[model samples]
Target: MSLNEWFERGISKEEYIDSLQKHRDNFLHIYENFSVPTSDSLSNKENIRTIVLAEEWCGHCMLNIPILLRLTEQANIPIRFLPRDENLELMDQYTVDGKRYIPIVIFIDQEGNEVAKWGPMAPEVKELVEKLKVNVPTKDSPDYEGAFRQYVKEIVDVFRHDAAYWNYVYEDMIKSLP
Candidate 1:
């Protein structure tokens, strides 16, 4: 089946929005006061299909999907969703170092050839992740678990209140699309 059919078979759009609205207050802040684009180049967006592969419970996915839902809705873009876990065969193709990552969006033309793909995060935030990764204890370390949890918490906290940070992300996302 096509990806759109797969998406419709999986989750209703309303359910997706409801899930987004229920995100933790901190993560929810990423969408607050986001200025939805009032105009977009129609010719550039025409006949493009966007598929968002994500997990409902992921904090990053929670922070990003609402903004996508709003902006794409306004732009009249035909976007769909697929759960990463449910599409392992397809999902495996997108892994980084053999580990699956959520919120990876695949963009395609009308004939289904890929145009461009963008996800994970914008450049600046990715730099932060790299910096944070360096401080995490290795698996062989006795303090691995605590250190890892602390790192995860720090990333989540960054996503919570970083409005200027998210602006760069949103702008990059819009620019990356076909």
Candidate 2:
């Protein structure tokens, strides 16, 4: 019924690691062999600190935490974790329409301003990836670097969308982290 229960029933750490490894291998292969752009040239130049409001017992939180961890690794971003129920006052700072969604990801700029917020939507993989690709230039464009940044941003965005992809990304991130 809970997120931890779902994880226990669906995937063990070993299984999660194995799947993540496959994704990492594939990502690396594509990254190295393909001419896909890198995220070094985006317009949003501010460094962000992410505040993840979630509960370990939440299914969505269980699924998205791993992906968030992975994106943090790949992007070298810093994140602070907080339990949604336990941190009610703090969680109020990042609610959408006054509702506290588990795994709500808040992006704060260097100035501590809330730049963007996303969550409460659980899109499938194809939709998630497509959403990422939006507003990003094509690889054929001269501004490939900028495009790549958008790609990276999209990857992070996808993690916020749902639990399955989040779980996949999170498993890989956990293995990769020190």
Write down the TM-score of every candidate: 0.80, 0.45
Top candidate on lDDT is: 1
Clashes (backbone N, CA, C under 3 Å), per candidate, total: 0, 2
Error of 2 at 83 (Å): 1.0
Worst 10 residues of 2 by lDDT: 2-11
lDDT of 2 by residue, 1-178 (tens): 3222222233332333343432344333322332212542322333755666665445445445555555654565556665577667766766777888666766666666666555644455436656667767877889888887768655644444434564444343333322
- At residue 66, give the lDDT of candidate 1: 61
Q: Evaluate model 2: give its TM-score.
A: 0.45
lDDT of 1 at 123: 80
lDDT of 1 by residue, 1-178 (tens): 5544544455545655555543546544655555565665435576777778887778668667666766666667777777788887767777866788778877777766778777867788778888998988789999999999899888877777666666667777888876
Regions more than 4 Å wrong, model 2? 1-46, 125-178
Error of 1 at 78 (Å): 2.6
Cα distance off (Å), candidate 2, residue 10:
28
